[model samples]
Target: MASLPNRKIAAAVVREDAAHRQRLLDRAFALAFKGLVYAQIWEDPVVDMEALAIAPGHRVATIASGGCNVFSYLTDDPAEIVAVDLNTAHVALNNLKRVAILHLPDYAHFRRFFADADDAANIADYRTFVAPHLDETSRRYWEGRDLVGRRRINGFARGLYKRGLLGGFIGLAHLVARLHRIDLGEFLAAKTVEEQRAIFDSKFAPFFDRKLIRWITDQRSSLFGLGIPPAQYDALADGKPMADVLRARLEKLACDFPLDDNYFAWQAFGRGYGKGVAAPLPPYLQEVNYAAVKARAERVTMLHANMTDMLAASDAASFDRYVFLDAQDWMSDAQLAALWAEVTRTARAGARVLFRTAAEPSLLPGRLPDALLDRWEYRAEESRDYTRRDRSAIYGGVHLYTLKAD
Candidate 1:
């Protein structure tokens, strides 16, 4: 079969060389990304909302990763949200989620399908309620056979949280920990951040020092499951050993936030969200925000296309908010300039752009032209604060920029 347009876009951004080794690695990463990558997005939507300052009547444009943040943004009642992605699976996932919210009988049914995410009854629910309303393209994707010949929608019945590329990576990490006689689950048992720190020091911290583990992490291909391309891996490493960087980031994830409220930690250590009703969830998944999200679900537009292309086709000054979700790290300088040119042209007065970086510094300064770069005022201090507070703990920095007054 010919490559999908979205997949082709992914190739264009990722395949940066023709050398045999480099070409092989790039092809492998693209293939891994072709299917579902993030069953749940790794970025913290709470931080995104706060930095974006999403207000009623704002037009928001974002990259649709796992569709978690897109759904979470609905609670803010934006006038419109255009979620564009170069992953067909993510596009289908986003469409499936919005349709589920619109057609599922109630919040209970919705919660059971997504939050619990492991019961076989979810298949019946999908068939009876969600599948009918889902766009035909998405329906085909969900109903399609996987490499193992099982239907993709069956993921909900078999621990949806444990199915995608990120999920598989986490599972492998857990297995590696098991080999080291460390149970990552011990961290999740902590009742306080103090206890979380203690557990990490005792059980998890030492695992990173093992020669075998360090060697595995040193390989660029080892990180493909986490969606880190070669260029992104270099940025993330920033001259430090990959093992050291991962350990520090994992420490933040394990100890910086309370166990009961940090869903990112839960996903990291527990392999899924906690089952309790009070377990932290993305805003859209919380019962308190259910009505608002459902009511605003229709406002979201899911597109399987490049984010820059989406902006290029949009009217000037049409969007007041943009979220790129670390995708700029994958772009060449020319690609970054092209993307920002569209962003600058399409942004409304006082518009805000939010994104994360694999490294500590914003990637735009020397890359984009001085003329275009000067149009936006970088929120340097606030971005550092946002990076500190971001619960995801995976990214090195979270940057925000607002368009300067014309």
Candidate 2:
């Protein structure tokens, strides 16, 4: 697509010699379930639910990730939702939630399916419980016959969680921890915030912030293990001391938000959070939304496409809100303009768009046409509050804007 000058922004040069678009399922299937990714039902507090909380009749579209936010958004009574992602492992994880949330009968079973997900019962649970409701691809993904983990939702059972690039990162982390004479198991067990902080600030802080440790991890090759593309690393390195910026971000993660509620922080520090062998749960799991997730599960419809492309296929001005997440960082300027054109085309009047980025801004003024940016109102204060409140602490900042319905 010989698009536009804005396309320059989309041309994010990645430093990936090893990882390319592989067949998504097999890649995910083969990647052993190592517990690096969150697999629970908690929603991220960074997403401004109030922005997305349109009238019950409105529709929504968002990146599904592990499916936590999908279910969480459903609580707002959107007429329908389409959650999309490019990662197959992420898709499979969402499929797993689809079956469990919509059909598993009750929250207790739900709890076991996710909270105690590593339990022995999950094998039969997959075959007899969640398997049938899954789509053909998803159904094939869970059947015990070909799975690596005959029991561990097969994701955990097959060691698939341990095998992916992210899993390898966890393994590397464990090795580094061992070398330091630190037990991750002990850190995860810390019952008090003081205990967690004490260990993190003293033991983990040096690991992330020191020059030597920083030098190694900041390299293009080292980050590939975590599935970070060269482009992402380049974006991270944008005219700044990359490691210093990241260290500051991690420190914010440790100090800016409460540990108990910020599960994404757990992913970086402890590897996983929530119950049941650490499924990729979201922040909403902390309380009342548990039942809400169960009840709202049926309302969601999932898809496989780019966020803007998928929405482009829909009726214009149909969706009341948009959750682009961090995908825009992968986009060039023209792609963003094209995507926003779709967003502006299909987004209802007064619709809100929420997203995150490695850098700390709305990202439109530089890349997007002035007229379009003019129509939206950036809730700078709200963005500041939500971004600061982001318990994940992993991202740099959260940005919010309201598209003028007029």
Candidate 3:
């Protein structure tokens, strides 16, 4: 498949002998993201809220993945949020969420439309309240039929969580587990973390040791559903058996957080949020934050462009908070430098930037130029603290960088 225009930015960042491999990976990632890959953003917003310390005066710029975090940030009442993404699908999803927040009848309707998405009434709500308000691109995206002859919006009526690439990936995992006579769905039945750990140790943990499972995981293509690129896979696979690394990560996901309140766990294990379990809802989907998000929906501006391009065109000191969301892992030294140059140029006084890494250490020090990197203070201790507290335990590290005082 041809790579999308927005993905060219990711392609341009590769300056290594592995550029050919990287381009192929980027193409796969682009195709994966061309549809709804993330039913929900994987990054934990609670850690973001703490690290960014968003105030009413903050103007934020972030990469819009599934737009879950973008909407979550709205509850903080930031001055403005510029949500940029190269993928048109992500841009459309972000716009759809923003419009739904503004036009949806109530919090209950909102939750039904997105969270408990298997109800037929969600399609009705989309047409009645959200469809007319959608831009032409988003309207077409939602209304268009997919390979199965069902309109994309119909996924809401038929379980939206089970439609996207990530959803398909989870389904594949379930199929494989079944082949091993292990049912991952059983993980959802645990009433406490102890049971969760017990289920994982006995059932899930043994699957990773299977020769078939290990062989399948060793293929880099098998992870396209997770949105990991070739370079990222290399970073993740560094000096470790891929299956073992994955087993440990899944263990963290299964055991580290209380399953009752970890939506990521629910999505991974049960394939959807369990019925009537409202506590695990994403911040934007939670009732207490709904009205605040709706009121501030207009504060967000969605842009279909590369983050580097978007920041390069902006005025100096324009944004106060930057959320990179693991994008830097794909960058080369030159690309990282160019991005930080723009970040440093456009960042307001005391501006803060946060990003995640596939590896444990921050990527900036050796890769980015010192003149650019020196101006920012790395919040090493705070970042370690936040990473531990992050309920979404997929990432290796979460980092925070603050512009030094003038």
- C-alpha lDDT of all candidate models, in order: 0.90, 0.63, 0.86
State which candidate has the highest lDDT: 1
Steric clashes per prediction: 0, 48, 0
Candidates sorted on TM-score, descending: 1, 3, 2
Candidate 1, after superposition: displacement of residue 101 in Å? 0.4
TM values, all candidates: 0.98, 0.81, 0.96
* Model 2: how far residue 49 lies from native, Å: 1.4
Which candidate number would show the highest TM-score if scored against the true structure?
1
Model 3 C-alpha lDDT per residue in residues 1-406, reported as the tens digit of each score: 4456545644643334566776676665655656677877789998899899999989999999889899999888899999998767678889999999899999989998888889999888999999999999889988998777889988889898887888889998898888878889988889999999999999989888889888988987778788777677777787788899899889989999998779889899888876784548888988888889999999999998889999999999999999999888888787899999999999999999999987778988888888998999999999999888778787888999999998
- The regions of model 2 sitting more than 4 angstroms off are 1-43, 144-152, 156-164, 189-195, 209-212, 225-227, 274-287
Local accuracy of candidate 1 as per-residue lDDT tens digits, 1-406? 5388535755555555546787677777777888899889989999999999899999999999999999999888899999998888898889989999999999999998888888899999999998878888999999998788979999999898898889999999999888888888877778878998888888878888889989999999999889898778989999999999999999999888888779999888888889979999988899999999999999999998888889999999999999999999988888899999999999999899999999999999999999899999999999999999999999999999999997
Q: Write the per-residue lDDT of candidate 2 for residues 94-209, one digit (tens) a residue.
A: 87787777777666666665544445665666667777778887665445333334433555433343444565576687788778776665665666677767877887667765
Clashes of 3: 0
